[model samples]
Target: MMLSELSRFGLDPFLKMRHMQDDMNRLLSGLGTATAQAFPPINLWLGENSVVVTAELPGLSCDDVDVTVREDTLTLQGKREPKVEGENAAWHRRERAYGSFSRSVQLPFRVDPDQVQARFADGRLEIELQRPEADRPKKIQIKAA
Candidate 1:
């Protein structure tokens, strides 16, 4: 049936088109779920003299993750090993993700690589980066005329 004919029965063609668009969007949205689940989600805090970054690394030890800083970028690399099952065990449900993952974050300002500090505890990793002395802002003296 023609769209005009369908509209004669109190059906709005625009409303139907909107519903079809919404359905298509909902269907395609799931395609990005895998990419959206970036491993070891992180939080960043920027301060006047330093920057702090914290990441969640559950089921991973300090030796499992690697943190690096260069110029204004920070990179995190890690691997999560899958749990070993019995020889005759069968899988019922598995939701946890396992494998190697890497994420890089860009900082607002360059950091002092020599002063960078990282600490891992309780499945969480915290990194502190200090701004270089030359990169800090200095106040200028005013001369009265």
Candidate 2:
């Protein structure tokens, strides 16, 4: 019988071969190379009078990161430089990315630029933005006429 007919019997040899080929491709491609993204992944949260932003930036230190805040927007910029190894050393795999990335986010409220705070720890960056008093939510009470 032909290989195509084997699919009917739940024994697809071609699929196995394709999976093997993909594995080989990945193994060959991960040699002292880096993958890059247009922007690093980030998470944002809003509080009553504050907005928080967190970004994932593995393999980078504080010195390599920069944060900028505008009236209602925040920007994160960072660089991940590749490591230097011995001249005789050969890399078997290098999946981590090494390059510069910038991400900008528009906040829901106008922030007090003077009250912005940023901290980086354990490969993550956390930014705290304080909103202006005018933008904070206010409760209204109704009176009987």
Clashing pairs in 1: none
Error of 2 at 30 (Å): 19
* lDDT of candidate 2 over 34-126, digit per residue (tens): 755446788999888898998888878888998988888888887788989999999999877777778888999889988999898999989
Regions of model 1 farther than 4 Å from truth? 1-34
On TM-score, the leading prediction is 1
Clashes of each: 0, 0
Off by over 4 Å in 2: 1-38
lDDT of 1 at 12: 80
What's each prediction's TM-score? 0.75, 0.67
